[model samples]
Target: MTGYRCEEFFGEGRRDAASVMAYETFVLENTDILDYLIKSDLIGETMKELLFVYKTLMKEGMLIHTGFDTDYEEMLYRYRNNEKDRVEFFEEVLDDIRKATGVNVRFCLWLCDSPQECLDSHNADQAKHLKEFEFDMYDTSDIVLADLGKKGKLCGYEKLPEASCSVQMENNL
Candidate 1:
């Protein structure tokens, strides 16, 4: 098993948000520099690693952003209700990501999905079901753990005095 990669987003603090925003702007405008950094340890080294290893059973695991209000579930339900609308919506997401990142990544419909859990079973009820992918992560909220960056922590991987379970969960994810 190897460590999974993640890039966190921040909302509140000016410093970390500014830093990340700068990097994002640079990557979006200067693809060459982004390419170079991806090939260099200078930027890559900023990626914080966790102790536990992730063993993705799938060849290429899908990452889902099921944030606030559990919209993913409703989004999937709507998409299934209208497949054509779903295609257009997904194309828009891909285009938005490409516009923002200058990259062409594959489109995997989240479908309230994870790598392991595909919806199956006789009963239609979904109350007691475990989501297929426990390996997914939420896109960071419009909140930044600013205090954690006192020692130059990027994703707040370093220990913080009053840490919550979410902090530990994010690192482990």
Candidate 2:
């Protein structure tokens, strides 16, 4: 998808907490960005990907401090109570996107690892998914980094050590 497409989603006015949570859930569920790597294509399948992205976003300072804990708790309750409707959840997400980004967003699910992998998947699938819809490709890892950097929070990454090693010999000495 084009940057314009992404811009459209973020152009919406301020979104409510429920809307934000729903949007995040939609991104988590529909995008093949994470599932493809974790489940379909036989790549890494750890929450590390999600955590990395979230941490990076937090570090980059692009994350809005919107008191999401209460929202999350409410959502979790609804989910656990079986009161959450999948279709409705997605609709709320779309609404949130419209409000937050001012542009309608769409997703094309694929089974691949990287942007290149997504392209390859699209080609292999005869572009069936792509033909049916227009969606912006989202790389969870990249998104995390970019969001964090966008918020000027990449210093968190900078604070992390390049490598961890122990000087056993020096300790003995």
Candidate 3:
């Protein structure tokens, strides 16, 4: 809502003057549109822009793909063959997504090492439990369990009644 300053979100010394100016101009030109997206909750404050765009395209049925092979890949190949750079091709793609979903996507990408192991763990259930323990509380009394924590024990076992000690008491020396 405030003035468009790229350095506010990004760092001051990250981008050159020319790149910053261009980004600022773009933001200023699309102020109203950005405001609309923000107000509509289409663009969240902390949400990653790439994720938002992907979700929006999937929601709007714009990205028609089979996960293995995609039409978007063919589009990108054609654009690359036509001497179109990545920036231009992606700008067009973003514009198309914006026109379809009314969300203007912008994000700063960073390079990082591959975290395939972590990603695999997140994607699949990699639990390594040799034996799974399951407890059954069927027909259990509710009142007996009320003091379980304080007593530090469950109510399943109780002390048996002591045998009569009359014979032992009579034989006392």
Candidate 4:
């Protein structure tokens, strides 16, 4: 391939200092846009993880749980002990980014508070109605949505359309 294939790295460790400073400034300047890209998954899973680590280690000055695969086992790992996995991944890549450029991107959920909820709604039966909403920044937890009334026991939440949700979340970013 003619490409350098640099996109394959876990932590490319090549974030230009100017780019870092620029990105930090951009994040500070356009916080909403950056968060939108994250919720929409515009940067892809790997870059999403990189940004997640960057956000935790640098910006917020605290770790967050991310980099989760939707597989049942991985979900279990994240669901049961997300802190450990997220933290370990952050720790593993923190120094490299520190030595190189810095962190990237924040978070936003156009249709719901968390990524899992978005996934849940995205995967739900097409018959359900979906809506777009955001949670208070202070509210970062997921709520179990059990079936009730005449619905089945595994009733799911309504979610925004997948491509539309991605676009909305990435509107300005």
Model 2 misplacement above 4 A: 1-74, 80-86, 110-173
Identify the runs in model 3 with alpha carbons over 4 angstroms from their true place. 1-84, 108-117, 121-173
Error of 1 at 68 (Å): 23
Clashing pairs in 1: 117-132
What RMSD does each model have against the real structure? 20.2, 19.8, 26.8, 19.3
- Candidate 4 residues 1-173, lDDT tens each? 00011111101232232232223322333233234324542235554564444433444433334653334334334423444454344333333333333332122112233333443444334413434322221221121111121211111112311222222121111
Candidate 4, residue 65: the lDDT equals 48
Alpha-carbon lDDT of model 1: 0.26
For 1-173, candidate 2 gives per-residue lDDT tens digits of 11111212232332233333334434333232222222322223244354244334434444334444444334433432343553355344334434544544332211122323323333334433332322233222121111211211100111211212111111110
Instruction: Judging by TM-score, tell me the better candidate of 1 and 2.
Output: 2
The worst-scoring run of ten residues by lDDT in candidate 1 lies at 50-59
Residue-pair clash count for candidate 2: 16
Tens-digit lDDT track of model 3 for 1-173: 00111111223332222232223223232222223333343323433343344334434445334352455444433432443343454354345444545644443211111222222223223323313211111222111211112112111111211212111011111
Inter-residue clash pairs, candidate 4: none
Against the hidden reference, what TM-scores do the models get?
0.21, 0.24, 0.20, 0.21
lDDT of residue 26 for candidate 1: 26
Quote the lDDT for 26 in model 3. 34
- Give per-residue CA lDDT, model 1, range 4-118, as digits (tens): 1111222222222223323332223222222332343322222211000001101122224354233443443344355455445434433443444454423111111112121
Give the runs in model 4 whose Cα sits over 4 Å from its true position. Answer: 1-21, 24-33, 62-173
Candidate 4, residue 84: lDDT: 48
Worst 10 residues of 4 by lDDT: 1-10
lDDT of each: 0.26, 0.30, 0.28, 0.30
